[model samples]
Target chain A: MTVPGTLYGVGLGPGDPDLITRRAARLIEGARVVAYPALAGGDSFARAIAANMIPATAREIVMEVPMTPARAPAQAAYDAGAARIAEALDAGDDVVVLCEGDPFFYGSFMYLHARLAPLFAVEVVPGVTSVTACAARAGLPLAARNETLTVLPGPLPDAELRARIREADTLVLMKVGRHLSRLRALLDAEGLLDRAVYVERATLPVERRLPLAEAPDPAPYFSMILVTKGADPWL
Target chain B: MTVPGTLYGVGLGPGDPDLITRRAARLIEGARVVAYPALAGGDSFARAIAANMIPATAREIVMEVPMTPARAPAQAAYDAGAARIAEALDAGDDVVVLCEGDPFFYGSFMYLHARLAPLFAVEVVPGVTSVTACAARAGLPLAARNETLTVLPGPLPDAELRARIREADTLVLMKVGRHLSRLRALLDAEGLLDRAVYVERATLPVERRLPLAEAPDPAPYFSMILVTKGADPWL
Candidate 1:
């Protein structure tokens, strides 16, 4: 009887190889089957971050997760990926799934975890999120004492976004690609434009930190904007 | 004349030693002087996490940062600590300030960074925060697909807490020590009691995860509460 192997969902942190945790590093190096999500044609960012650590003899599984607004297609992709991961687990091969950020924080790994937890022994390893990485790179204190910090997705309606900006003590906007213009206007209306800093590819070689007003017209998908309402003495 | 050495503010992640990033490991191990915040009586949690990696011959500076509601004493402590650190840097000793979680995210390193940035070179290395670590430990997804996640300090007025709880799709309440009862009542008032999960000392050996209702009467200062207002199909 072959014993079922455990499935590990490991976070690789935000783009930098050195940011990978020691626990994640050990698991990635020892795993017999390594899996990561990729676009239809592009390489996996999570896998690329730990490329140096993964053993050459390990079997790789590159699951293609589409980058689309529709949730149905994405759900389908995860379902298929989970099945592939399950096959390896059933075959007594411990599988390591690479995730970009903390697996449970607005991550794609949740889709697989949802399907696989009931059937397999799964463990999650958290990592340095872009939220913290961006704040560090921008040299901005995210919150202090009793200040409230709000994290909003960019696709939210302008009215809700404006309301959140107005009420939040510190603001973080994620997924700021196409919604860059709309977010800029909302921050402007709330008089938070100057307080806002946009970060793209934080902690990476090509990282960019700029005032929200000076950022390019089209922001990258991985970009985020951080706004500290109070005066920044460090800046 | 000795060259002024750069100061490195390194985040040590939540609690797990293996969770430390490679960048942080290198800096901590190679630093000439390592400084970290310590309570008057208790050992520094940041130093304990990296105790294995720090070089035995390195000079250690334990800065006593008071745990008081008043900010004046805290500021004074940091000011004095910064002066002490400056002496090391001025003598061409690169000092590494060890911080738990991301340095800029409500961390003590911010106080030191504000004082030292103008006079000396400082670099911040981000790490995994308790927010993400607790979410992963509790087996809950924080936010996804345009959902707004609000991080509130537990000291807020009940009315304000209730209002933010109503408006937020996902919420994380930090510094949840004595205010656990108040926070529970507010969640109940918002009909979110069942959705709340409390985590203490995440990633540490003494980690605890429970439904908010099941958590101890007096929550530890190191605890946090995560509430997902919407239906979490992944969970």
Candidate 2:
């Protein structure tokens, strides 16, 4: 039984229902109301991932989160939505906010959590993050001991990017769709492009992988670039 | 849909069969053989997580990694395991090794990868590392945007530990069950002992969470401590 005055921030796992942790599933199934963020497009893939697990009788609330890269107006929109969640908790309605990965790992759920959690008791139900799921799908390890693994968002300064690439033995560059060509070049400049792999919508049923040179249409914004210094250690 | 020369390394999500990513599941189901490292106890948790996913008739190879703190014997055992895998691939079988969490995070997979990868096609699948999962399970975010997050194993010089705690906004101390008292003292010195959370077997069915003080028999290993400096942003 849940203690009073509590909110659960649940992880949906990366766009796959079966990937939800059993704990997350139980929480959602029994939650008084299951909350999720959506855009004008409606129920997001991440939301759908966990929706199947929540019983049909449970209330599903789609609090919109601006999907476009956040600028002034977008941030304003997120603020407004977070306010809606706050209003819910005032009525003693417990919420289970569905996030794509571990709610905090580069997912949009943080915004909602930030806004709603302050006045309410909050507990995070961690789910598998996409990086792990991607690596799992790729059948690759994140790093070897003392091998140094680096996680670089696509927007870092090129020098920072290069230094991370030079320093780490394994690198998982996230949000690289827009920066694919630039990242590809960086890898090539470092002579490691041939060792890179592209994973698009990893762990999703529609997932696919390819050599860095052969990836189709440079992946969606959800794509990542995984590079290794030596060879696949498990080979 | 077989790729002639490529080998896939799939990481099963830590200890939970249902937590395995859909793509990891797909690959395992399709692979001709599945391999996993076993310790003294047989039918490893990693293997158990992948069991339902693999083909019913697929070959299962077990590489026994020693269970000890020693180095050389462990290294040699990994070398032998790598040799056996090499023999399998030499026979033209595509092998998928099930690692509990991203194999490279901390495991024998890295040793085997180093030994066999250069000579054969290989891939590393990442799994839910204990840190991210533990942090999430504990209802804490690892770090905010600019806050430094340090990942440290126990047994570091006290000086290094102090420096890490001083620099990082979020500290994930791994291998701490045995070293609990030392960690407790360090956090106490930093005035964070009460705020610290001990997470054991995070995301698994039997996962447990308690304040550092509640750990009656501090486990010295696999347990993680998440120390957060920011006002609970998601609280």
Candidate 3:
């Protein structure tokens, strides 16, 4: 009987290759079979981050997940990907699944984990998240002392977004793609536009940081808006 | 006159050395002067994480920050440390300020960054935070989709904590020291004891993860409580 091999969910960290953790780098370099999700007909950002580390001789599994509002297509992609990954594991070949940013933090790896964890030994290597990356690039200190930090996705309803933004001490609004204009207006109404800093593709060569008022409309999906209210407590 | 040196605030990730980013590792290895803060009478956790990579010829500045509720003493400590760092920068020697976790995320390095950023070139390297590390260790995915994630300090007032806990979709309560019993009671009262997971000194040799009900009272300062209120959306 062949013993099943372990499945490793490795986070590649934001977009910068230099930000990849040593442990994640080592895993990528040593893996014989690697798997990663990519946008259908688009490049794999996760693989691109760790491209140099992945051995040329290794086999690659590309799960083409469609960018859609519906969940069915993405679920099907993961189901197919999991079946293929299971075959590798059943054959006693460990598979390293690449994830951009932290795996468990709104990462697609969670779907794979939910499916495979009960059947095989799975290990998750944490990576630096985009929240901290945006914070670093903006030179903005997030929450300090007892201040509460709230992370909200920009797709939430306007009423909910307004309430959350109003109550939040320090806010990080992610997935600011087509919702940029609405978010800007909300912050502006709250008199928080001056304090809000917009960051796009943080740590990458094409990264940009500026005040929310100056940010482009329909910002990239990777963009984020960080707002720290109140005086600088550290000072 | 030689140009003033740049000051790098490098995040060392969680306790595990392997978790440090390649950029942070390179900076530490090539640094001529390194600075980190320690508890007045205790060892420096930041320096200990990067001890192996720090070159033997590098000058080390250990700022002993007294752990007191009073802010005056800690401010004085940072003020004193920044003066010494400024001197090193004036002599054209780059100083890498070692920080555990992301430098701008509730990090003491922010104090120094605030003090010296006006005069010196400062760069912040993001790192894997304890939140993600704890999530990885606990095998608990934080927030996903449009779900909101709230991070609160355990030191918040009881009423505020209760209100926040009720409103939060996903909660990460940090600085769970000396407040475990109270937090546990609060979670229990809110019928969330079963959902709350306790993590202490994540990614370290003595790392521990268990249900919050089983957690020790007076938990370590590095401890955290992660609670996911909703059913697994990915599943």
Model 1: colliding residue pairs: none
Query: What shift in Å separates residue A197 of candidate 1 from its native position after superposition?
Result: 0.9
lDDT tens string, model 2, A1-235? 4334567787777666766665677777787777776776675766678756777776777766555544555567667766766666666777788787777766666766777666688887666777766765665666544343456677667887786577555677887777788888898999988889899888677887888888765558778888867434532
Instruction: Give interface RMSD, every candidate, in order.
Output: 2.3, 4.3, 1.2
Give fnat for candidates 1, 2 and onward, in order: 0.81, 0.35, 0.83
DockQ each: 0.69, 0.28, 0.81
> lDDT per residue, candidate 3, A165-184, as tens digits?
99899999999999999999
Tens-digit lDDT track for model 2 on B1-235?
Answer: 4334456666676566655655567778898778788876574778777777778888888877676767666677677767777777888887888877767676557666667777888876555567777766665666443333455666666886776576555667777866788888888998888888988877677788989878746673557787877634432
Q: What local lDDT does model 3 show for residue A14? A: 94
* TM-score for chain A in each prediction: 0.96, 0.89, 0.98
lDDT of 3 by residue, B36-55 (tens): 99998869999999999999
Model 1 has a DockQ score of 0.69
Q: Cα lDDT of all candidates, in order?
A: 0.88, 0.70, 0.93
User: What residue runs in model 3 are displaced by over 4 Å at the alpha carbon?
Assistant: A231-235, B231-235
TM-score of chain A of 2: 0.89
